[model samples]
Target: MKRIFLIAALICSSIIVLQSCSPKTTSGAPAVKRSGVTGNWVLNNITFDGIPDIAVKSFLGESSYKCFIGSTWSLTNSGNGSYSLPSSATCAAKTQTIFWSVNAADGTFQFKKLYQGDKAKNVTEGYRLMLAAADDVNMTIKSPIEYGNKTAYIIMNFSKAAK
Candidate 1:
């Protein structure tokens, strides 16, 4: 009985480990094709909390215009797990480096922007963009930001252009 229980436990743990370490597939092999992310992706919803006051102040005045930002994110996959955002429609500020990464094995996408501030040297933060479905044209990304009294979220939705 003891040996049997031990074997069962081992098997369970091994399965867990394998699943955790397994290579992630975004949309399987086809998803990572040479021209991946060509289709349109809308920002359906965004959820984030624990944002600093400083960040919130940046978007306060233009609350109405906030929605206008990030309208489109055109992704052009260079190769491997790397890609580029040829143009980001709604970003008002100027920046130097923009980085994009994807977990082809897992189907996870991330975009980062590096900025230099007065107090800090260089701060880089971005969100993880998740696809809705294989055929779904909507995608959601979440990021936290501070609102009026407390922290709140700024969720936006984006729709893909029809071919």
Candidate 2:
């Protein structure tokens, strides 16, 4: 009787352990949905206060615009990524390599300028872009900039790059 009881207890303990160690599953349910920003994208347009920005139009019209080829903005599932500007961009829109993140709670996209090989240095304090909309293939972002005495919305649109 003692031997039988000990064996039964051991088997029960083993079964409990095995069940706890098993991988969890959702029983054929789909995985968590990823954010739409997790891919390479190209700048499509820029608008300032509901009007097309001439500087952006001129920048796109320049011959050096070809240099923007292969330049990409990449976001991650974990809300962090890198943004690389085209090398040949104009002085005012010069190349910038920065780290970016999305704040889902506030619907804001935050950017931090990485400097001197340090990810924590030269951060842009309080500079955040409001995400207007984002689908699998497109995203629109808006930021307020002081234009003269009033604030103007700088809207940027991006299209996802082909795989």
Candidate 3:
């Protein structure tokens, strides 16, 4: 009977030692938060193929690039947005409503024109801008445009507009 008690006590003590010596497990690091792209943005700078281009600068004029400046590009949570350019001496008055989306997998930014009342036909192909960098306040996008016979990439820098 004494031998049997000793054996049971040994097993119980071994179990307690094992439980105390076991490694502790903890939760992993917290998940990273992704930055959103919905906001009003204004044009900050423009470049071509990472360098300044004289032709594009001349074409875009000193004031506006395809009527992008002065007008605010408003992006919504639903990926729908609009920008209105008032009638100016250089360009006509126009309002453009568009649907935009950014593909995280490929870092592709796409913009589809929903309505352009000034134009006779709606734009179908739309613009595909490659997202270079985007944060809460700043965004950089690259767009390939056919300049004459050669292709040139237009890099546009945008900053979040103040309320």
lDDT of each structure?
Answer: 0.46, 0.62, 0.68
Could you tell which candidate, 1 or 2, scores higher by lDDT?
2
Per-prediction CA RMSD (Å): 9.4, 11.0, 11.0
Residues 10-81 of candidate 1: C-alpha lDDT, one tens digit per residue: 999999999999997553433442134445454433334555333543431333324435444545454112
- Model 3 pairs in collision: none
Candidate 3 Cα RMSD after full superposition onto the native fold (Å): 11.0
* 86: Cα error in model 1, Å: 15
Encode model 3's per-residue lDDT on 1-163: one tens digit a residue: 9999999999999999999999975444222112456788876666678334665643322244645545567888777787666566776667778777777656777777775463314456666667777887888777777777777788878898998
Top candidate when judged by TM-score against the true structure: 3
In candidate 2, what are the lDDT values of residues 63-86, reduced to their tens digit?
443334445677666545665555
The reply for model 2, stretches above 4 Å from the true place, is 1-34, 50-71, 78-80, 87-95, 121-126
Task: Specify the poorest-scoring 10-residue window by lDDT in model 2.
Answer: 55-64
Best by lDDT: 3
Which pairs, if any, clash in model 2?
Answer: none
Q: After superposition, how far is residue 138 of candidate 3 from its true place, in Å?
A: 0.6
- lDDT of prediction 3: 0.68
Arranged by lDDT with the best first, the candidates are: 3, 2, 1
Residue 45 miss distance in model 3 (angstroms): 2.7
Q: Give the TM-score (vs. native) of candidate 1.
A: 0.38
